[model samples]
Target: QLTGISLSGDQKQKPADLEKELDKLQTEFDEIENQIRAGSPRYAALTGAQPLTLAETQQKVLDDGTVLLEYSLGNDTSYAFAVTQSGVSLFKLPPRSNIDKLATDFRAQLIPPKLQRRIVGIDVVAEQQRGLGLVEGPSENLTAFVASSNALYRAAVEPASNSFGDKRLLVVADGALNYIPFEALVRSTDGADYASLSYLIKSNEIVYAPSASVVAAIRQSGNKPSGKNLLAVADPIFSSDDSRVKGKAGVPAPAEARGLGLGLESAVNDVAGEPTAAGGLRLARLVGTRVEAEEIGKIAKSNGSQADLWIDLNASEDNLRSRDVTNYRIIHVATHGLLDAERPQFTGVVLSLVGNKDNDGFLRTDEIFNLRLGAPLVMLSACETGLGKEKRGEGVIGLTRAFMYAGAPTVGVSLWSVADKSTADLMADFYRRLLGPASSNSASVAMRAAQLGLISGKKYSAPFYWAPFVIVGDWR
Candidate 1:
């Protein structure tokens, strides 16, 4: 869509106005996502045939700051190396063309061999022995980590890009991490347009924080030890907060919907000055965060129906498992969600704390299904709950689906990392219009009102306003 316009240095044309300037900026990112996705199919053409081969690879960060990857490139072939999606590769890969024609098998190893490691995640099922599947390293490289931490996050986002043709905010986790990459985690929130990115870091909120049960499942797969790369958030950013976002929180907060709308406009609607390209639009307005119950009440108030709103702020790893959610009319969790093509169960939500004490913890989707949710709706306001291992009977198996299967009629879930500041606004306004005194509106009507609240910028409206909340299923 980008025709590579030539700017006139002679009499430089500034944007006609503010909207024009923003449109220019928005189109730039729009083109980037489009270009990458458009280029995916061509990768297969750059293939070289190889005989039976089982490839071994390693990823390393050199002293000079260059990420070095060493891999076996049979006798005669010109191959370029690319880092895999995970920041945990201990090996290198040949040029995408050379390996495109060969079949491969990928198995993870425990205890990284080197300190400066590259590549954190990979999918083994898509192995193509004869150019059937494209190599994983033919995409984006993430150099998103603090220099102080001495950890560099390198990823080949091509696989995920190819898997789901739709544009998404792909989050790849490092096995079991002692510290979540808080810095890298925050950068992508303004996928498109979000209000005051700084405000989000300050608020530290999210639609869903993973449940302990789901986090445990992700851990059992390959995300244990607080060092391995196991979490990845790949979801979409819908720039509107539908007030009737069917979740717990009985006494909906009293706030207008302007904040979230503004957030979405800044995150998704603004273009910084680029022309709208042909085809669909894609921006990175997702908000991603990690909050535990101890920090924000995990267990709902009262074990019965009235308990969904105020979860026990004291709910920690010790209480996540024994908790039963069958009585509520709606369920809302601020947790994590993962999609593992190799292991769906390994794909789960991360709880706020890790330890057994009232320290927040992870939860699995399996447990979400087990809940006797008498509630008609649920909200897994966490990252990637809508995404899951692409399988047949399994369908979409993250927390959202788990609750749906467990008998919840409808649910509201996010497709990517959401902006915290926007999330607070989305939640507050959604509840205000849906369950608050203005309970006489339909889902769509409530959503429009939320959008209006964002654009209007009333007391509660913010740029991160409308883009974080999404309506899932039929919220009639």
Candidate 2:
């Protein structure tokens, strides 16, 4: 029987290796079960070590001026654990239903009807291309958004802000709370509007860790001190029928543009169906993302690091699986992502789905845990990529946790479906701050700066454009 298994290698085990290990474990467990049925007392359950106490955790993980706010949700109530360098304390929260209602209303307000689903009709392409596709910020919805945000902030933070005051906050959100952007929350009790003095981003630098234990493990390992620059895969050509498949000058017209007669691009309405003949998971063409990728590549190269930029047909799951991606300091996957809430295991980031390359196309949630990534940061620029099915004590079971278990210290993900052009603008600003001369600031600080930039912009000032992206895991 294998007693010790460690997933710490720079190169993570491939899916084949993981499957073999599972099979071997099942065989060993069967033998143990047979002995136990025969009245053998040798098959006792293994008892793990106790978790670190607040004080113990502090000495080990909390840096000066940094505080940890961990939330635990119940059917009717919630609890928060606030840990600082001085010590730790627990606080009470509003009912779970209240928080849930607030989050639901908040999301519905942010995501526009046009952007709600994948556009299928070329007829709507003209409409979508117009500003109508951009999320509109009516004054009433903005007021409600601020009100909902204020309610959440008052519930989650006011109880502990005396101790948490002015410190860089590291939040460990639970359940529906994960969908709430703590930074976007209105400042406590300030009568002023979000445009003026009430936004939380104006007050504190915040980042999120999956759990307190994760922080301890990260601080303890401190491995991968320095890493190679980046591996950026964007603008994947998902179908063999795509005009770009033949290396035409520009992106050949998508199915709708080519007048394929199918009104909308074939979206995966039912996961049970077989792969379509077109040979790729069909999605709207993300025209702005090509520039997003090129800009980041240029930035990484200027920093004396050769970032491997895989675009169009080359950005396949096969390319990702074949490479030892742990070497990079950053892994930027800018593409469409899907969440199968009914079947969490099926949730994954969509890569080049139907290319000529031998590839499974989908990088599912299960496969992500098998990766041994050493990058400090992994950015997922897709809608609702941060979400997952909720389970008590476990937190949101999604891609964010998968990456952390696979060894990334930080992940940048979106809470809702984001506008493509706005994402490009925010990311370009974010990387510039994270990699430019002002990089002395932590990830969350840099993130706030980027968000503020978008908030202040004349054209893209709506919170819907910039507020969805949140940095999960370590800010430092």
Candidate 3:
């Protein structure tokens, strides 16, 4: 059985320092193995054996009105434990077979091509209703979606949620469940319309953790980093042939631009009742995220805090891999994240493809643990960066855990592909709120503010545009 060891109460090493220690231990273990292979006498001694108990973890981490829902997903069935500081309750949720399909269906509905044309200057409720009509075209689709959400809620949450009332939920999901948007799960008891009471976010704040021990690790390392306050890297060149590589004023190559145009044309064709390949909808460009970097940079600078904003050629993978980001308080990467679920180790964040004629830009999953990043929060503003191949006991084996293993206490990631422009808007709002005076600097609080802005804002009220972003780690 796999056991998660939490940090002892007196342990005070920074996450980066802890990461360094782990690396040293691994090196030592490797040396010991070599010595054993050479037929030399080798000995290893273990010191501390105080594994954190359930009560100790609750006492150390759970605040009042906070419920931790930890899940264990087996091949056919799944079990859940709802824990608070006071007690724990177990519940049996729907099997993976049922949830996998429903969640996949919900995710398919969130794709941009499936959503309605978002009209500006309309009332929030009206706009949301319009979006529902377009996205959930048939009346039966709305009923089915609602039924699916309600079924998930009842099985996974209702048993525990009723006891916790309006408490915020801290979910530790496993397997395909890691890809779920808990906030989007609906509970309709009063016959309210889809836009009126269709989302769990309307009821409570939801966050995620890789494990209970990870939560303890995060809370123990909650102190802010002492180095630069913000590091925002965005708008990287994904190809060496990009015009910006030749210093042509940050323009895309003519062929690439044309390809993007064709991609859009194909998307339009899909919207006009013509079938198109799923890859067509996945098309992306050198996103206009330079503005996002600049706006966030201004926020960090406003309060006499230091901020480093890297864009275009400067946002190379080599730059990220070589630098020790342990000192930064916040690290934000606004680029494409290539998720290879079939080969999770190949999953990587796309950075500057080639600049100054050097360095491949894909930052692979395996390479993440090599970095020492003690930042309290690392934001991946990219598509499906949160997903990975499911392991039996390890949960989603992806970049989120990779970043955590690298020493980041929290990682903000997207569950699905998001619109570049909407992401920029949401991120700008998030940073402004997070870095402002009188701000709590609590990532989840700031994230909620940003999500609320998108949900209520005129331009992007649809849940598909905003609900995908989730904070997985310490919400504090």
State each model's CA lDDT, in order. 0.32, 0.65, 0.64
Q: Which TM-score value belongs to model 2? A: 0.78
Count: clashes, candidate 2: 2
Report the C-alpha lDDT of model 3 over 227-329, residue by residue, as the tens digit: 4478999877645454566755643333222232222222233233443333232223344567778888998899667899889777877678777667788
Number of backbone-clashing residue pairs for each candidate, in the order shown: 121, 2, 0
**Candidate order (TM-score):** 2, 3, 1
Q: Write down the worst ten-residue block by lDDT for model 1.
A: 103-112
Off by over 4 Å in 1: 1-313, 317-321, 339-342, 352-360, 392-395, 442-448, 455-465
Worst 10 residues of 3 by lDDT: 40-49
- The Cα RMSD of model 1 versus the native structure comes to 24.5
List model 2 lDDT by residue over 186-205, tens digit each. Answer: 76545544455366777788
Better of 1 and 3 by lDDT: 3
Cα lDDT of model 2 overall? 0.65
Better of 2 and 3 by TM-score: 2
Better of 1 and 2 by TM-score: 2
lDDT of 3 at 448: 80
lDDT, candidate 1, 386-458, per-residue tens: 5454332222335555655455545666543433444555554554565444255433345446655564564
RMSD of each: 24.5, 9.4, 12.5
